[model samples]
Target: MALQEYTEFITELFESGKTHSEIATELQRIGAQSCSLMTVRRFCSDHNLQRRNFVSDESLGCEVLSAINQTGPSYGRKFMTGYLSTLGIRAGEGRVGRILREVHQPYNILRRQGARNLNPIPYHAEYMGHKLHMDQNEKLGMFGVTHVLAVDGFSSKIVANVTMPVKNNLVIYNEVYRAAVASNGMWDQIRVDHGREFFLSLYVQEKLSQHRFNTNRLPYKQTTSSKNLRVERIWPEVNTRVNYPLKRALVDLVDTDSLDMQDNNTKYCVFNLTCQVSQIGLERAVQSWNAHRIPGRGIPNTLAAGGCPQRISMELLPSAAEAARMYEDELGASLSWASAFGTDPFSSEEDRQQAEQVFLQEYPDITVLFDRAVNNDLSLFQDALLCLINATNRFA
Candidate 1:
């Protein structure tokens, strides 16, 4: 029954969700040893098990809630407060709000529905607002939901996305407002499978009336899983092409020892500041997909602003053209073949001859696409030949 042994037991208890005081009293009850609150807290910190939701009122409210729950059913804070006082538990109004929001949450208390459904198009407003399917999912490394503003999974286009906490309806509307601003105006209909925390926000009606987008919203819950989400496809491409690149640019801007640096902060800053860069990045991503990097993903690269090229390259860089030429030579066809099956995938005596004729007739002998605009090195262009792949490879 050493103090250290007692402390170890107390730490285990705390890890098991037992309070410090409970551990203290229990240790003394077992006639082992006792520790102070400060020791218990320090141990918690050392183990990286900081107390969750450390608001004073939160802990206080949980105490109050536990007391009330043992007694009877008190629907919300107001009912619980009045009921608790009958048993001599008195708390202030401000304290209730804090406790309710932070500690004893009334929202998640009840499990109403598990899965969400996508109902048939209800009698809703016409055009612009019809069946804009919405879903939420998280990204790796950053464990936060990326609220997807989508339409049909078959029609994969990112209408909007919010990469922040969705606290309530007001917060969601504010995010929706930001997304709408990015997309010109409000959408007509918002079709969701589940009733989210922000579903009740009057922002939908208020903003609709103000901007006169005259939008209406409808919710359905055919299924709970967000598997068939068209917006999810964008996340992978975006992670690879947009988000990862942006993350890298920012990392490299500060990475003094980085062997691969993109000049100064200009490249990183461009994406952060201008929607144009975002638009172009999005376009290039679609183009990459169109190149059939995946089995099927070719689609329009139309961005918000007028069609601007994301892959802005100067005259073909010498190295880029050389690489392009090497790719062409290995393929034994013009640059067109290099554009299609990469440098070399398949070669047949007859197919090679046909490819040579096709490259000469249909595609130019030496077409040029500016190289990867890397490291503020627009001065260096990677000449990639754009030969159309087999039409069968086209993805909608």
Candidate 2:
């Protein structure tokens, strides 16, 4: 059969950076159109679908720089190559490494010689939702920023994540746990560190244990953060991609006597702004990570895109309202969604409104502000601090 009939489908797979062999195999697997690798290659050649036909090294280097800026300089040759492929830039690892050395020598050296110990502990998961790993990252906790993420073990996909001023139990329950359940259905078991912040989430997980796809195993397990390998492994990436850069900027502010960590008002403004920016970085990191193909495994987002085995009906799971009711019953306190990040930073509601107005007037785009800060533009941070301080004083 002529390959032209499957032109659109094959083009999509090719544009997704799949090799001729993989595309041909997929075509055969789906029984759409069985074609040999040579046929697929010839077809691609005929249609001028070559990934590097006219691309130049200078342009590729520019793309590498842009990717490095967004993902930070920690990505090695292999990962960077994969990341580039995800962007439909089919550069080889050797070429990517050469460019990385020329573009970011310092970071490349550090990444190559970085002291990273491997965890040899054995881990197993039956299916995509077999085991859910939840953990909190406090690398930026000193800056009054914390991040919580839930990762699916089998697929290594981040199912849910949230940024907050602190590890609030209610926020973890509502944002991370419930959000994962709402999006992907329930997991067979949840593994977390032994922290009180997970109390509410674990409580609800246990309550819904009976409805789990597999009830033979325990509903949840509390272990050391080091042992929670699935989620723990992501912290370093988070540190590199999100926390460290932001921390450096924040530290610069403190060293320059521009930010006061001890002051409640200053902490409040810093936490709110930093958390918002950190969340954006975290989201980008997650996107890059999910789409980047794993060495032996497939792309995380693709592998986990298909719903888990033993599909559980949504009606069987507790609603958000019902989960809140359960929280009230178990904790003997009213279920509250309050969080330090959400709490008013100013003295009064009116002051908070005025400060927000001033902030918006000065920095309308938080993302732009974050990008500037990441690039070592401390002036923006200084200006933001001044804007908030002056705004709060206006209503004081």
Candidate 3:
């Protein structure tokens, strides 16, 4: 196996934006006789082959500054590094920090939660489903809503979070509880502040019992926020990423008189447009938070790892039949049509319109539901939509 024989192939892969490791893996997959990661790295280094052009330090500094301005100084080193990667700037924290220093970029020192306490309570969770810390942030009430969040005690990964008009018990059960359990599976126990919204529900317990797990809830008073640091820490990220942006947008909407007239009096508008926009913003934040790599963290950085609560515990997730039955029981009707609003099933505008029309015709009730999502109470449309499809399949 001569190195010269595959030089052109390796160069082509490199030019095509393949990393050395990727190129080596590809070669191996194609049965390259002498391909190895070390060989690829050595060849690239010897040939002066690089991922991109060698931009000046000043140019890279400008890019880093621009990213910080877009993301704000509030983002820490790891998030900034990940954000830069998203922009095709493949640099480590050391390089990123140097650029920040060179550009005089001031890093925001976030005050640690529970910092004031002389002796903070030590908490630990041995596994992903060991304990879920549940809490609600009403800071977004100015934007006419509140966010309910569930964070895993172990990896600090968010289990499930939802923005709702009112933090009602039923809404918590349906949106937050169901979401957490269905996605991450049943925790052995959940800890929450003594809010009636979470405490009043036996619904969650009943559902967990069906999975052969007796889920317990430990409620604390207002003083427990310091002790419930797992979910409490998540609020800062949510406030910066989700709440702040929406608040500014809502204010702008009000100033422009863009809000639905009927929704003006409410603390939060449930208008379809408002809900859709808010939902997208919130979900994107959640995804970003989960995907973020926590630096120097003992656990896996990405939430896709089994250690993170964001990764579903498949063993405890309900079967298709059970999920369908639960949906029918909750919504009080069998879902009859397929909806593609979130799925992006159509590629063309004409096809999208056709699909939308077909869905509206088949599920006339969706108009009512959409109206509810928009003009009145907001519901978790995607979950309900999925359940409807699952239920339909069961009947078919």
Candidate 4:
């Protein structure tokens, strides 16, 4: 009397309105071994021959259904399982899976096809400021703008993001790196592509070396974007949220020729306007990105358990003077930096006069040397220029 042999007959009797106890008793009367009621019940349940009763309570059921509609068909059993937990439901994955199947929710999750080999190595940093990723996106170049971004490898928080007319090294230094470092402080290592825009790797190394910290340059060439996943992931969001809208606006403006789009000056005016709007959109996108919750982590970068990158990197902030000096060295005399530095450092006329007096008192002999140079007095240093240098150094 094998249970497998009785599966069909037992299913038929159970479907004919026979209870588990009655079915088990009838089988035993035929000397087909003593099958308990529990055994029969388990068999029917496992074989799907028993009718599953839906939950009578509609309170939690209504909430779950509402979540299904809100989350869309893309969400699967796993996501719903976690979501239900967050909603204070005690249902397990198995229960949630059954409910999803019963409700006929399609598994429309958009996923890449084909199998990918598992990577055992981790690409994340253990602490904030430990590592940062730098990357540039040129999809918006048709509008005469490029976007450069920096992201923290640990918190995935965007440290700096900027829109520039070109992807030159000077622009990258002034707009991207400087802005990020100013706000989030210095990072131990910066991982970027081997593009020339980041060619000042040696310069960065030199700056960090002054503070007794060895700045590691992780410049990858011919490598996949997976290596810089932290920053690479941000491009898609930026494109969809910011670039797409800007592109549409630009196209509309061109179609309308609202501001004399043909004239060079007018074109530039419109270009600048578009660039400004693009910049604002980029900023808002970054803010929203930092505030949005991370998958599996369940917290925004700003409120992460490990602390935001800016907060964790508080010690690395450079003074305005120091930051200015760095920008000067990295980018040379750019228009923006020139405007910032060439402007008067003195606040008032009295302060300017006092500084001028101090400078004249310290280097009074500078004028004498200047007058001599103007007179071409070459005989003053017949032996060597070292004496003239010494005199300048020794100034009265």
Model 1 lowest lDDT segment of ten? 379-388
Q: Give the TM-score of candidate 1.
A: 0.27
Using TM-score as the yardstick, the better of models 1 and 3 is: 3
Question: Each model's TM-score?
Answer: 0.27, 0.78, 0.53, 0.45
How many angstroms is residue 212 displaced in model 2 relative to the true structure, after the best TM-score fit? Answer: 1.9
Candidate 4 residue lDDT tens string, 152-205: 777887777777665666556656666666555556677777676665432543
Per-residue lDDT of 41-98 in model 1, one digit per residue for the tens? 5656666654554445545676665643332212234434443444455564446545
Query: Model 3: how far is 180 from its true place, Å?
Result: 2.4
Give the winner by lDDT.
2
Which residues of candidate 1, in runs, are more than 4 Å off? 1-128, 140-155, 165-171, 177-189, 193-223, 243-396
Which candidate should be chosen as best, given TM-score against the real structure? 2
For model 1 the local lDDT of residue 260 reads 24
Residue 112 displacement in candidate 4 (angstroms)? 16
Model 4 alpha-carbon drift over 4 Å, by segment: 1-122, 200-202, 210-226, 252-263, 303-396
Backbone clash total for model 2 is 0
Candidate 2 lDDT over residue span 1-396, tens digit each: 478889999999999999999999988887765498989989998887978454567988999988876566667776677677767787767678899999888778878888764667888887888999999999889877999999999999998999988888888887898888878877888999899888788888898787778889899999988889988888888887678778887888789897777876677777877888889888877766776677677878888987555455666556556776777887797644555743455567776787788779888877765665555564675577667766765664
Please identify model 2 stretches exceeding 4 Å from their true place.
1-59, 78-98, 102-106, 315-321, 330-337, 341-351, 373-379
Ranking by TM-score: 2, 3, 4, 1
Backbone clashes in model 4 = 0
